[model samples]
Target: MLRKVLECRRCGYRTVCGRDDLVARLRIVGQLRRDKDPDESIVEALLAEYTPLMTCPGCKEVGLKANDADDEWDDDGDWQAAVLCEICRQPIDPERLEFLPETKRCTECQHKSETGTLPDEDPEFCSRCGALVELRVSRGSGITRYKRFCTGGCRGV
Candidate 1:
């Protein structure tokens, strides 16, 4: 299973795709490797020909390049270099990023969002962390409805 990314030469749009997934419908399934067989040339060509059609609606090949997507990220402390918190615009600390690299909030903001008491008024997501918002609505006897977050479970960290 080779995980890769395809970059569009026209617009530079990138998308993650697996080699197996890309070649599944290409009619070449018996070329990867067997018990102790050596690498095959057909498999290599199929992987190299992975096009940008996986993400687009139609076929397009302006020069689809295959790159190891997994190689883009590592736990080598570089991803934590510097990023702005989407909530309070605070600089993220590299030390804290070791665990929560995708966090969009600082420690304090994350805590507030978890407790469901974020300071921002009527925040759709976490006011401090900018988490996903789960919208909820209830129906009454006849016709009673007003857009609102039903409860604290509406937002997730």
Candidate 2:
């Protein structure tokens, strides 16, 4: 039977058995060709290879992978995945790319958010004291309720 093969044009790699083939071939290639140790995580190896794949052509620094919906691929090969900025090790959801790289008002602006910040908020910087407004919450044990607070010197002011 002729199966619909998924081909990665940038690397000239083809897959017919979905993620399984990609995972298996990556493991073998890593071990034999790359001479990577067997103790290494295969999934991590696969991810490393996948990052440079065609998704962001010539831009290996930023990459995305499609996460499995209900533990499987979507009908159109579209699903949400963890977005990784390889240069900064900052991860965000692929679906919600609120701040892409190389933007003037991007959250990456040091005047705003620091490195390793999740791409959620724009990060408020206190104009009065030049301090960033950060909120920290701690959860312990089982079944904890949600609470909110304003961090830094912004409390009760």
Candidate 3:
């Protein structure tokens, strides 16, 4: 387990590891959390409560979600802006950020439309640039046609 800290700039939420033998201990807990024991229920309950993060109690109260990173600003020396993709909710590829700078979809999710599958968003041209728009569809009796590419463009990137 590599050491990493996840701090939310939105609500001061912070999850720090290796603060106490974190790596070595986390390795063992993975298996035990799967055991069919009563404690396993507790583990699931706690994890469900926190979801992606453990907790700082106060931070959860403010509802400073990971999505809030869209308006993200650095809160401190170590904390940086959120880089999670709006579509897949995963870390946007650092390389994509290098190229597009404002990419909100992970590469896989972004390419879904390219593969002829429409994403959940409405079809329209990219708001920033009138690039080749993602394909949106309308189903028919025996075929599908382009309703439009969902709204918005390449994010001016």
Each candidate structure's TM-score, on Cα atoms with residue i matched to residue i, is: 0.29, 0.20, 0.31
lDDT of each: 0.52, 0.40, 0.45
Better of 2 and 3 by TM-score: 3
Clash tally for model 2: 0
> Which residue pairs collide in model 2, if any?
none
Q: Positional deviation of 42 in candidate 2, in angstroms?
A: 14
Q: How many backbone clashes does candidate 3 have?
A: 10
User: Could you tell which candidate, 2 or 3, scores higher by lDDT?
Assistant: 3
Which wins on TM-score, candidate 1 or candidate 3? 3
Worst 10-residue stretch by lDDT in candidate 3? Answer: 63-72
Lowest-lDDT window of 10 residues in candidate 2?
27-36
User: For residues 1-157, what per-residue lDDT tens digits would candidate 1 score against the true structure?
Assistant: 4555666666676655444344432332222222133234554566666443233323443456667766554444544224545565456687778788777788888888889988763334443343434444566766766554424453333
Task: Pick the TM-score winner.
Answer: 3
Regions of candidate 3 where Cα sits further than 4 Å from its true position: 1-78, 122-157
Candidate whose lDDT is highest: 1
